[model samples]
Target chain A: MKIGFIGTGKMGYPMAQNLLASGKELFIYNRTKEKADPLAAFGAKILGCPKEVAASSDVVITMLANDEALLEITAGSEGLIHGLHEEGIHLSMSTVSPKVIQEIQSMHAAKNQILVSAPVFGRPDAAARKELWIITAGPLEAVRKCHPIFQALGRGYSNFGEEPARANIVKILGNFLIMTVIEALSESFSLAQRAKILPQDFLSAINQALFRSPLYENYGQLIVKKAFSEPGFTLQLGFKDATMARDLVESYRVPMPYLDVVYWRFLSALNHGKAELDFAAISSEVFDSWEDHPPLK
Target chain B: MKIGFIGTGKMGYPMAQNLLASGKELFIYNRTKEKADPLAAFGAKILGCPKEVAASSDVVITMLANDEALLEITAGSEGLIHGLHEEGIHLSMSTVSPKVIQEIQSMHAAKNQILVSAPVFGRPDAAARKELWIITAGPLEAVRKCHPIFQALGRGYSNFGEEPARANIVKILGNFLIMTVIEALSESFSLAQRAKILPQDFLSAINQALFRSPLYENYGQLIVKKAFSEPGFTLQLGFKDATMARDLVESYRVPMPYLDVVYWRFLSALNHGKAELDFAAISSEVFDSWEDHPPLK
Candidate 1:
């Protein structure tokens, strides 16, 4: 099968590389085209646009930026569907909203193309490890057909049965948890430093107890070392997902009062123009919450 | 060495039992006399109050609730100091504020009483396994004196050195991380369920990846079951620690905006009078955030 990848940004680039490294017949396209060169060196055939990639591939996987980009690539007249074969599959791994996934699923179904929501959880490093946990939802038959691709890009995959949006929802929820860890670690660590708690002791203690997770360890290491210069995941996306989650809950009359506060924090970062930095910069925001600390890194 | 045990409630009782079973000469006291009986049967001396326990032991171990109860036994004329010898050492294992630990240190100094902040990490069950992680910060000599007792109550103890509040601060930060996980799990699990994502699959998928940790396995079970009945650490104390963290941050002039949201979820549980329930009851708060599906028990 010829595999085409859309969105060659941070995660997409490495994922595409892994697919090509797996010796699969792979094609790639990026809106900027510049992102295609790195993968081209990895022997991936860089195509012109979404439609071209979609037309030649059996499965086109998307790891786009956000809802707008996802909608753009999947919904236009010359979008992915314009080129997909009736038996083709569109596997979306982007952390998108359920509604968007549902819409994409509906349109793909109309064209006799199958849409599979296969959102994976991992940072760029984790993705590089082929260690992402893929939560798949959509047609089970479609998912079965794409098992080889899932194996190419990730370590493990779980079938969420059908309902592709359900996979996206889980992805969003995972993001929500990540943000919460980032925020909580930021606040608590900052508090500890201010109170003169030794960092070696602090990190070792939390990591051993209720924490003891790579996500917490990953975020805690960054916060403890005050490393936010080059971000693996930008603050803007963190803010974006939180806002998406907040909308998801509120639109359905679900009262995510806590998420409402998290959304505001994300907006606050956007307001302060820290959106382009690492989400660990939320640590700086947390530090600012205290009256005594100067600011975050 | 003679061991003094104070605050025999849920946690203290088990911890004291573990110590007494280890064959130490135990002197026990609790605000309520009835709590003293179980241990009293095992060759443990049930002292009437803080003063009595202090006068009779070389080392006094306290495992009270919040900073208030912790202080009540360690402060004032009728407190631990009234009976502590010039050479006595007080080992504090309660989850109290770094500030309070500092205050206790000051009070202990006047009586030449050594204060060791040894806040523990792990639930009551873990405590019984002697599987709890104990963090110690105080004089090296004082820690040496309490090493035997630490061995009895926990699998191992890590020394933080000299500044006792630093250990308390580490404990607070650890709790902060736990709360962050709780709140995040609550939000994501609830949202995922509404989006047709089977929260179990969502959690399993995430937990299998970066989200995997004993913290998730333990607390995630509570949030997933919506069974907040077990009160290892009540929502009330959860809120207290969060606020304690917030207070430290605000006092330090740090900005912890994520906590603003978590505090409210905790407040929601508190508002609904679920403060006495398990901290995982924050699940309801997350459930309340989404309105599409009614809710799952």
Candidate 2:
């Protein structure tokens, strides 16, 4: 089966390369065409646009940045909807909103095609290692047909059922959970610094004795050292995820009161011109906002 | 060394047993007295009051419930302070306020005695296994002298310098961080359930991928199952810790905006009569308070 891939940014580039390595005939596209040039070395064809990629492949996957990019590539003029043939499937691996996926699913349904929501859980590093978690949902037949494709891109897959937006919802909530953890680490590190305990000592103790997790170890070290200059995931994108989570929570009518704090911190980080820094930069914001250091009130 | 053990409750009982088994001459006291009875077989002498235990022993350890209990046992007219010798040191393992610990320290100083704050991190199960993390702070010589006692009672110890209240601050902040995590997990689980995904599935994926820690694994399962009963640590005590954290934050003049959310949720849990349940029961509160479930706004 032929596979077309779109949006070859940091995450998508490595993911598409893995798909090509798995012996799939791959057609790739990126807004900045140069981003897809590296994958051409392995005999993958670089297409010009999403529409062009869609026309030549039975299964087309889009791994764009946000809801806007996903929408433009899937539903805009010169988009995938104009080119995908009947019985074709458009698999989305972008972390976008459920609403966008729902809209795209309707657009695909109109053309007698399938749209599968299969947003993944992993950083670009995990993507390079082919260690992502493919959270998938759509028609059962479509998911089953794409199982081999999922295997090529990720370590494993969890099917969230037939409704395409279910996968998007899960992905959004998962990202929200991650931001909440980062905020927790930020606040604790801030408090540790204020209390005259080194953030390193506090993080070391908790990581060893209680929170023995990669999330803590990785983010804890980054936060303790205030190493946010290089972006693993930028603060701006982290803020976008936080905003989307707030929207989802509001739509669900759930009182996620703590999320308000996460949203505020992310926005503050961006406001302080930390848009290019790692999301863990929120720790510095947290530490700075403490009213006074030692002799508090 | 003659050791005085006060408050033989869930944590104190096992800790006292470990000390007794380590061949220390132990004098144990509990308000109800019966709770200390089990230690008698191991040659422990069950005394009538905190005063009696303190009068008979050189180094005393108190592991009561809260600030009030700690205050009464340490400073009330019939308390340990009135009974101890001039050079005696009181080691407090209960989770209480930095303010309360400082007050108790000053009271001990007035009597030419010493108080060492050495709160622990572990559940009753870990306490039984002697794997608790003992966090200590006091005079350097005093903490050094109690090294063997802490070793017998815990897997390891971290000394936070000579300020007796420093250990209390760290314990309070550590508990606050744990509550923040529980609240984050609850919010995510509530959202996952709303999205028609199983909390177990969401938890399992995150645990395997990012949060590879016992804190997430243990508490995530309990919250997912709504198995908050049988009290690993009760909602009531959790609320107390959150309240103390707020106090500490206010005293330190630092703003922990997220903790306001945690404080409110813990109070809500207690108000909903989950006072006797495990702290993970906050997940239930989070689920119940959702304005509507499937048909959100």
Q: Give all candidates' CA lDDT scores.
A: 0.80, 0.86
Report clash pairs, candidate 2: A296-B252
- Enumerate the candidates' DockQ scores in order: 0.49, 0.56
**Candidate 1 segments whose C-alpha is farther than 4 A from its true place:** A32-34, A38-43, A75-78, A198-201, A288-297, B21-23, B31-34, B40-52, B66-72, B75-82, B97-100, B239-271, B285-297
> Per-residue lDDT tens digits of candidate 2, residues A104-184?
888899999999999998888889999888888999999999999989888888887899998888787778877777778
Tens digit of lDDT per residue, candidate 1, span B1-297? 999999888778888889988999999988888878878788899977899899999999999888888878888568888998997999999989888888889988977889999989888888878888888889999888888888898877777778888777777777767777776777667666665666676777788865678778888888887787868878888888888878766666655556666777887788898988988786687776554556443
Per-residue lDDT of candidate 1, residues A1-297 (tens digit): 888899989998888888888888888888998867878777888888789999989999999988889889988766888988997999999988888888888889999999999888887887888888888888888899888888888888878778788777777777777776666666666666666665545677777755667777778888777687798889888877887777677655555555665666777777887888887776666655653635554
The number of the candidate with the highest lDDT is 2
Worst 10 residues of 2 chain B by lDDT: B288-297
TM-score of each: 0.88, 0.91
Mind giving the per-residue lDDT tens digits that candidate 2 earns over B106-151?
9999999999999999989899888899888999998888988988
Candidate that scores best on DockQ: 2
